[model samples]
Target: MVGRLVIVTGGESGIGAACAQAFGAERARVAVYYHSDKDGADRTADAVVRAGGEAMTVQADVDDEASVDHAFTTVEQRWGVADVLVNSAGLNMSGVTVREMTLAQWQRLLDTDLTGAFLTSRRFLNGRGDRTGDAAILHISSIHAYAVRAGGADYCAAKGGLSNLVETLAIEEAPRGIRVNAIEPGMILTPMNAKAQEDPVYRRTLEQNIPMGRAGHASEVADLAVFLASDQARYITGARIVIDGGLSLMQALGA
Candidate 1:
């Protein structure tokens, strides 16, 4: 992966930051894209550089087509074209039930989670043009894509759609040598789970539900992301790998 141009969305924090640093460890050139947290993005980019990789920070709203295109264009002008796209930009589930969810709320989550994936993936493909070989697109999805949480209708729906999107893109791009896949993580102790990261009492309560007896760390997921984007996973496409410590497996246990 040395010198490979890689684009990481949501590079400001969490899984995205871990992924940026992990790829940097492989000596890949990384474009860290942030929404608003410029400081966090810069910190992540610095970590990438420290890990023996080239790094640049770009401001992008993954949901906006213009912004996505501009961000990719900036990288393309610097480098030729990106070799990989790691879409980690997304919003957590709004704890509103279907009955209570407004149209705006539904659109907002979908815009960032599902629609953003589409925009970035499409822009990546557009930037590639006729060039294709060993390229990959990885989406950081959730186990809720199938687990169906009561108050996560918006989030669950978006991830559910992302599953189809990944599969469809995999088939469409396979002949072109571009692999696409989804990483459905259960419980990772990122900023998204700030409470769990700060409180062992609360964290243990959730971990008890996971068969592995603990929540996963961001680096663990980042390792898997690195593998998926590597040539080692060349045959792995159109598949969604779960890294939730078996938490989703217990969905039907109490029933």
Candidate 2:
């Protein structure tokens, strides 16, 4: 992977940060994009350098088209073109039902989780990155796309849309030599889910639902990301690989 360029949105923390580190370990030139976490982004970049790889931090709100464009332009100017894109920026708003969810809240979730992927992928394509068959796009979707929660209507909708988007893009971009795929993760310990992790009862309730009897680590998901972006998955496209550690299968089995 030496000299390959990768751009990871939300790369400052959580699964995104793990993926950045994984790619960097392979000596890929990584662009760590963060929305409001420059410090976290910087720390991730520093870790990449410490891992004997090259990386740079970029600030961009993935929900904003201009910011997305600027970030891709910066990547192009610095690294010429990106070979991989991991769309990992997302948001979740709880306590609002479908009827009670405000317009702003719904829009906010859609803009960040769904539109963000669209904007980033468009910019990456327009940046002339698709000319290489080695280029890949990975979307960090959620198991909520298939599993439902009471107050996660917006989040579920956005992720569900993303899953379909990945399939569509995979088919559309195949002719262009680019592969598109998504990872639908189950409950993972991250800053966004800190409250869930802190609540013992809630945590146990979540773990009980997983056949693996545990939540996944960000690094575990990153491992799949690295594989999917590498030559190992050259023929894999239009696939929504579930990395939920048997949660989906258990759900299917009524466990």
Candidate 3:
């Protein structure tokens, strides 16, 4: 990925930040996008530079089309068209049941998780304007896309839609040499799971359900993301790669 242009949304922290650093290590030019965390984004950009790559931070609200467009525009103006895009900006579930989930909550999640992906992907492809190359789009999805949870109706539904979006885009853009794929991650040691990281007892109880007896790390997912966006993963598109250390596998073990 040396000299390639890589854009990672939500790159301020967690999986997104890890991806930024990983790509930076590969010597790619990185544009770290953050919603409202400029300080975090700056730190991530520093990590990228320390990893032997050039980087800059851009402000972007994934849920807002104008904001997303402006972010991409800034990158395009600074560099050329993006060679790779990592959509990681998203909101966690509210843990509210369908009966209790407000319409506002549902819209908020969908806007950031699902519609955001759509807008960014569309803008990216349109920006290319028939210029075909070995570009890639990686959507940081979740296992909840298929695996249901008690109070995750908003989140699960959005991810489920994202899975299909990735597949459809993959097929549509395959001939253009643009790969679109989804990474459905399970429990990971990120801010999204702060309680797990803060309380060992709670984390242990959660890990017990995972066959691997542990939660995945952000860096681990970043490694997978780098591979998927590299020549090493050429011809591997339209796939949902899961990296949960067998957490999803135990769902029906005793059923």
Q: What is each predicted model's overall lDDT from 0 to 1? A: 0.96, 0.89, 0.95
Model 3 pairs whose backbones collide: none
Highest lDDT scorer: 1
> How well is each residue in 112-165 modelled by candidate 2, as lDDT tens digits?
999999999889888874375668999999888888778999999999999888
Off by over 4 Å in 3: none
Model 1: number of backbone collisions: 0
Compute the lDDT of residue 140 as modeled in candidate 3. 100
Q: What lDDT score is found at residue 255 in candidate 1?
A: 71
Consecutive 10-residue window with the lowest summed lDDT within model 1: 125-134
Question: Model 1 lDDT vs. the true structure?
Answer: 0.96
- The TM-scores, one per candidate, come to 0.99, 0.95, 0.99
lDDT of 3: 0.95
Candidate 1, residues 1-255, lDDT tens digits: the string is 999999999999999999999999999999999999999999999999999999999999999999999999999999879999999999999898999999999999999999999999999998999886889999999999998999899999999999999999999999989999999999999999999999999999989999999999888999999999999999999999999988998988987
